[model samples]
Target: MFFKEVVASLYAWDLLDENVDHALDVLQRETRTNSTYLVALMHDEKRPLTDFYYPHNPRRKVYWTEDSRAYWRPSPDGYERIKPRLSDSDELAGTDWMQVLIDASRARGMSVGAELSHTWIDKERTRTELADCVQRDVYGNPFDGQVCFNNPDVRAYAKALYVDLAANYDIDYVMTCVRGFNPGRGEGADTELGRLVGTTHGGCFCDSCQARAEAHGVDWAALTERLRWLADGYDRFNHKQNFELRLLLASTANITSLLVELPELYAFLKFRADSLTEFFAEVRTAVKDVSPRTDLRLNHYAGHPELMGLDLRSVAKQLDSIRSSDYAEQSGDPARMEWKRGYLHNIRRTVGLDMYFLSAVSPRPKATPELVEQGVRISAECGADALTIGHYDGSWLDCLRAVKSGLDKVGIEIRPDLPMWQRAAPALDGNPPHEIVPSSRS
Candidate 1:
């Protein structure tokens, strides 16, 4: 299989291929790389994602994770899931858009996976933290590593949500859940923490986190003391006003090296490592019980671990390993000046960027020839199987072709481990227009 050979896969290509046929058309047009796999998503109240017409459409089945909160809303069409709510349907809504995509993508020969939306907590079940992994809610209220492992209610809930979809709807993989996103910047806070007008977003101070840590063999009180130590005299640093420009200068390596090597810190802040492992195992086992041949992958951002109380590398090693999302704006696009700098070289996912793509960064000049090459080559050398050049609502220009050409030469040839390779060390383009936020790891 194409996926078994390639170390990675890029989920989207050119933003074309609405469904199966469109994808097949691309495969027919190209020489077709054997090392890549396509990840197909389902769309509801929209076009069928099938008609996948490529040689390397999607090797796996399907599942869908969409933005749940309006703050995360990509655009007008983002809120289709659980929308219009449910009526007389015996099993929730009739095969959600996720099911549609999974069914169609499989028909087109793609691997489907779901990172279910945020709002859909098992209707009859209570949202409780399991004695497990660390995933926090919008309020920074930590969630016990998901309940799929030890809690039968959770396991059964997940099974019901997905199993029916797989058989009745024809999907292949379900990503279980999107790691709970802790909206530290106060997307919905009535208090000072919510305002985040200019304060540190010391994330997740919840009771469940304390309990989950205990279940996972953590010394909770000791960990709390360590956190206090880490935050000593730091309440003065306002997340807004007191933010320092120099923190941006701190190298990602300086910040990343810490979390990659230390699992204890993950346990201390996040609850427990074993619980996460068992949680992922449960997801896989549960999916397998229904679709024995399907692949399961848990979602986690490449560089967000340490900053967000997550251990991404550990999660990567724990799950099946597929790179998720990377959003950035390039100098070629006019909007490039709008976004601050966000790079992904330091991530170990650089080693397994299976099924991924680039999104946002539009307005032409923003998708600069320089930025495109840098981003794509970074993806390839880091072992990305395929790459997606993204644009919102069809705003892409020729930057993709320009970057692709350069990639044929110096792009994938560099080694990620070497310092020289990371930058080739370019100087600032003089008086950059935007003041991008520096690494959160600092």
Candidate 2:
């Protein structure tokens, strides 16, 4: 079965002979995979793929620091400082790895796309030692890093960097790697393990943001606090509880505020949304600038209300296409798969990112054909365009089987493209790289 376009989340930063050979073995063994793309979602200081991949490399680790050089986003100063650097120490086997993958796919009679990492702004970096990278809601609640896109500096820097990356790596498809701004889990966020609570991902309330809020005739801090309140409340409460408080967070909470304090929130959010709109526009243009033939794809990362501020439909009316992911993890329980539809539905409406459910990180090398059948049918209920079996670089028998079984059920072919990269194995505690750094709680 040939997929429209299959891809792999290549975590090959530490690819060794054994790993590469292992991936090659899988590449040799699996069948029906067509035109597998590479997921360059990497952001170690030594691994700045964006210099040759995406514009404005915000080297954002999952809830980590912004991944870019002298990058900028929204802050009271009107810009977040993100210095960019180049990682050109080592060379992979291919002359132009991205293009090589494209050529390889074409040789296999398949079209290819690259979900290259556009990750530049890491959400979780200690802005100041002992200072949390993110902030709490205005009223002091759940903390989530707000990806501030309004800063012209970040846009300028990202555009400049993207131009270089796209110019260098010409693949068939180009999509920015949307990442999590919040991490360490929220109080009531859904997790494979249990309840999650932390103040992560919310961003600065600087003078510039205040100015923007005032310009919009609003109290910037108040509005920001309101948004954080929503995130915190959601973190503190389960999905249902968050739903109950949404009205309060969005509007009712503002009812009692002094009119002077009211406009800032609206102003700040409006500025944020408009700024992102501008960035995306620039991203589309930059990609076109680099490789006119390349198609563009963007992500809505869960429900980004800020991005939705100006109506994502209107904001991104000009881009080629946008994509979203369910990013599902493998599970023993069928209900986990079934239960995910709710998450996707809300993301679709909230961000209006026109997303199609993409289930990845499945317990591959372990999934049964029956399990694949059930998951495939259930995931498709959300109007998924296609299914790609996520194959990590460890004990991947189940992932290979998942590809075959799910494709068989969906009447698609297995795309046997080479592993563009390798990723770490799923952690039992959902915490790989304990050496990366400890959470504030730790």
Top candidate on lDDT is 2
Q: Using Cα atoms with residue i matched to residue i, what is each candidate's TM-score against the true structure?
A: 0.50, 0.59
> What is the C-alpha local distance difference test score of each model?
0.36, 0.43
Model 2 RMSD vs true structure: 12.9
Q: Candidate 2: minimum summed lDDT over ten consecutive residues — where?
A: 433-442
Residue-pair clash count for candidate 2: 63
How many clashes show up per model?
A: 46, 63
Candidate 2: tens digits of C-alpha lDDT, residues 235-322: 5455654664554444443333522343433343345454445556666666675577665555444443332333355343434544
Compared with the true structure, what per-residue lDDT tens digits does model 1 show for residues 1-442?
0112111222332122245345333432331211222232211211112222222224322323221211111122322222212322232223244444444445645544444433333222224333222334323444433222224444444445444444444443444334333434433435432222111234444455455445545565654554443333234463532233124223243334443443333444343333344444455555556665554444444333433334455444334434435545333443532232333444443423442322222213345565655555455545443343332212233553444354555533322222211111122233211221111221
Compare the candidates by TM-score and give the number of the best one: 2
